[model samples]
Target: QFDQTIDYWGGRPHDDAWRAAAEQRIAELRTAPLTIRVNGALGAPVPGATVRVEQVRHHFRFGTAAPAGRFVGTDADSERFRAEVARLYNTVTFENDLKWHDVNPAEQQRIDAAIDWLDEHEITLRGHVLVWNFEVMPPRVRDLDAEAMRAAVHQRVTDQVGLYRDRLYLWDVVNEAVTNTEIWDRIGWDQFPEVFRLARAAGPNIGLAYNEYNMLNDREGHWRRSLENARRLIDAGAPITTFGEQAHQGVPLVPLPRVLELLDEAAKLGLRIEITEFDLGGVDDEEVHAQYVADFMTACFSHPSVDAFILWGFWEGSHWRAGENAAMFRRDWSKKPAQDAWEDLVLNQWWTRAAGETDGAGEFTQPVFYGRHRVTVEHDGQTVQAIVERTPDSPDWVMVSLP
Candidate 1:
């Protein structure tokens, strides 16, 4: 057994017989420790060997939703929201926190606190919405004509992005613009380019997303229209980075196959996919809901284009849907069946941990997620600390020095 297992072969050649012997010798490394010496020319394997691999940052993003301040609560509620959100999720979208209709100084204060905490902890934040219609739209804008409305929209986009430009992880540049709402009809559906354009101008590096619901049910080709809208934004030169599927798959949802099929459609738009607002409401069966969450999340993770998945609300105490407790956490801050199910998958099953000691020719290799990893190598009384980043775009065989 040894440390600093990099390349000991140092470009040595071997014949078929030698290769066979090396394969047999390496196979034994899986069960026990081994050591070997390199000829520096023949590349001969003398005996025992092992390889270790680690991931630094994974490509997948698993997250959940929360409301404003324990709903912006005082003590217990605030602490629960703060601690639990950090415990489980890596990304979050304010349930109704940062919307335009409910913007207030106090609410903004609560929001500032949340974003600050997330930033300090290196968590991701998603802006719920930027451009919307129907009641949520400002009352002052109703009377504005097409040109004025466009100007108002631009101003709104510019102002919001400017305010949170540094802390924004992703922006819902436009939300549900495919509705039959007359306000959108007045301003021109094609104006999303302007809305998306403003967001990019203010926060050039922020991820801009077009988020919409009902894409799971297809709902009269609204999903198709949503994709078309995304493309239109791109055509108009808006930096649209993700297609958000608000996977509100109804109370008693359809089979997982159909759910995956719907997710696949959004993925085809050539943009990254995010299951932005997910909630298993309507049906109250906890057992079924837990299974649905696990299955649904698995489907989303299986897709190559899908990267971020978020639940709308995960606690009965603060769920947006009144009286309906379609949450993964109980009101008393206890873990529900669904919570355990999702956690079991994201934090346990797919989580990687492996160890191996190197042969005389130093080399350790293992399959791990693409991310930054803290690597520790030890032998005898010596210890080595290394920061290794395993990225999909990066090649294998990282060299770590040991003292």
Candidate 2:
């Protein structure tokens, strides 16, 4: 694999300056000053109280594409798969179970079970897609005539989006529309907007995403075509709430500067940008993959419009392309360099876990990552803990009253 991809994408920059700049930007954009105020029942200050602020979940989604069969199965590898997902990701997109081709009674049952597990574990699930004109389409759909094709598209949107309405965080209403235009070609260009309208009607609260590939990695004519199509859909009344980039990269990786520039271009659409399906392929060197992963993540996080970072797959056992060479972990679950880099950033550097004592004003102030946190305060042998969240709109101070 290494020899094959040696000259594939091109030479990646070995400089650290761009990454350093991105990290600095992360410290500015991804965190905010938080003041945890401790007070008694009667509003008296509880100075000197011990306080611990541990982040519970990120407001920024970190996730992977998970296979429903493995997620809901009762085997050892299945157990490992479930455990790894829950431990590592706060969200997941169903790999194929929710797609048009794979949709079946058996798959639906597995999806239902997986939904239950995700809810129980407090993990958010994203519907992979409501419509795709590519390989995942139902076999005979392409052969249908205009009326039948229109009905098929509507039914597909209604069934999946309606079934998982409030359960999913987002849905790829129309995927890969730039290059894959069979749906629109058959039903007419207006059909594109109608599918989004149907999805919105079925699941009004769930975010609708316009997803595509190559826009970020290659960034040639594909990028312009995708952006133009997105504008066309929006102008025709499609309610696209987010832009999803399947940032699957080959060698001669997209540079850090280009990565940031592409994000800026997507941000011009005025919708949140999500790194929907991120993974580096073709390169067999674990170190190369790890560094690029870190660089890409830093670039995304530094951009204000980017909201989520989700891998196409995490385990080599379950990856779609390049198998063992394209994922963070090997098939045997060994720690690959990519896995270490991901954990080091997600679990350590970017995570917030601070401990301190309140001041004379009963306030313990700390700069923290923007996310949900569990705050525990101990005063005079009484312990009080509460779940708190910090966002751009949230107040800097959170008050916790003692018993």
Candidate 3:
């Protein structure tokens, strides 16, 4: 009697039936990981990466996770990286820390590796910089004479551009060239034209951008100088296609309207635009910061002329500006409130899903909408929201929208 009672409690018919059904359903729903594909190329898969899909809720709240899978598409290492990004972000940008010195230190292998990684994962790669007056150039090149420097610049640009000509789409052709006039004076501003010229010659189809900081501050003189330089480059037939503003506001205090105004003016130039490096730091209010990020992305994405927006680094642990937690992820790879805010406002609410419908003349109309519409889409069985708006003739989507 005692043995029979123990068996009944441990393995009752009712409990065993329910457990078997649940296990069967779980096994049936499981997939062998999703592959990352970009432009018809298979991207590397990630393993052990958690992919969470949530719905967009009212007032910037993201819904709970629905369904997710691990990475199993490529080599083990590549798979790991891809899984990492897929778990946290739908979009990823390649960084250039190793490119400036390490890759070209003596050869292009390092640059090639970085490019290969992006290609393998089907990640959108932004050539961090073709020219920056500081922080990028090695001391060896800095010490070169004027002629040698020009030659060096020409070689570097040509080689780099030629190597990644068709692979990379956007480039920061001349970074911070205006911020420090003394450096230009020392290196000879004339060399700047050559840099642009060589890059165009090497990769004419790629988008070339001039990047700088503090333009949003509305410093009239500085703004004028940067614009003038851009105009000169454009007028000279340089492939100056985009204006990249490094919108790293040290504090979360930039005026939203002012930010819009700057973007509007850039549109007038008829060039593609990007908020190349954006980070709003020094604020502890997660809600406010999330709103600020959403608002900023909305304004940029709403503009037809703006193309793509890149968060400098999504994880605080890997961010260059360490002390400040400006990324969407905390140090431990967990999602910060800002991450949810961005995903809700930019991906779910702002992005348009492919709906089946023909707008006119039997042409299938894509789900994309124009002029600041809140987007709601299902990812991983969860609903998310983002604000997306664009005018005709704008090249890329800006992810700046406020709730």
* Top candidate by lDDT: 2
Model 3 stretches with alpha carbons more than 4 Å out: 1-81, 87-93, 102-111, 353-403
Measured on C-alpha atoms, candidate 2 has an lDDT of 0.86
Which wins on TM-score, candidate 1 or candidate 3?
A: 1
The numbered model that scores best in TM-score is 2
In the range 1-403, model 2's lDDT, one tens digit per residue, is 1344465446655345677778888899999999999999999988999999998888789999988887778988789988998888999998878888745687678789989999999999988888887467777886888899899889889988888897999998889988788778878988888888999999989999999999787567999899888888778878889989989887677777888888888889888889999988876777777877877788898898988999999887788974637888888888789899898888889999999999999999999999889999998899999998998789988999998
TM-score, one value per model: 0.81, 0.94, 0.66
User: Clash totals for all models, in order?
Assistant: 18, 3, 36
lDDT measured at residue 377 in model 2 versus the true structure, 0 to 100: 97
Q: What is the lDDT of residue 348 in candidate 1?
A: 60
- What RMSD, rounded to one decimal, does every model reach? 12.7, 2.6, 18.3
lDDT per residue as tens, model 1, 297-323 = 766776667778898878777787625
For residues 1-403, write the lDDT of model 3, one tens digit per residue. Answer: 1232223122423212233443343223211111111110132221222222222212111111101111223555435445556444423445554235535342355445555655675454667666676457788888778778777777888987887788777677788767755446766777666677788889978878888787665566877788888887777777678898777764525555566678777677778777777777765666666766776666665555655666776666557764665777676667778788776755555533443321222222232433334433332334435543333434333221112
Q: What is the lDDT of residue 268 in candidate 3?
A: 76
Candidate 1 lDDT: 0.68
Collision count of model 2:
3
Worst 10 residues of 3 by lDDT: 59-68
Q: Which of 1 and 3 is ahead in lDDT? A: 1
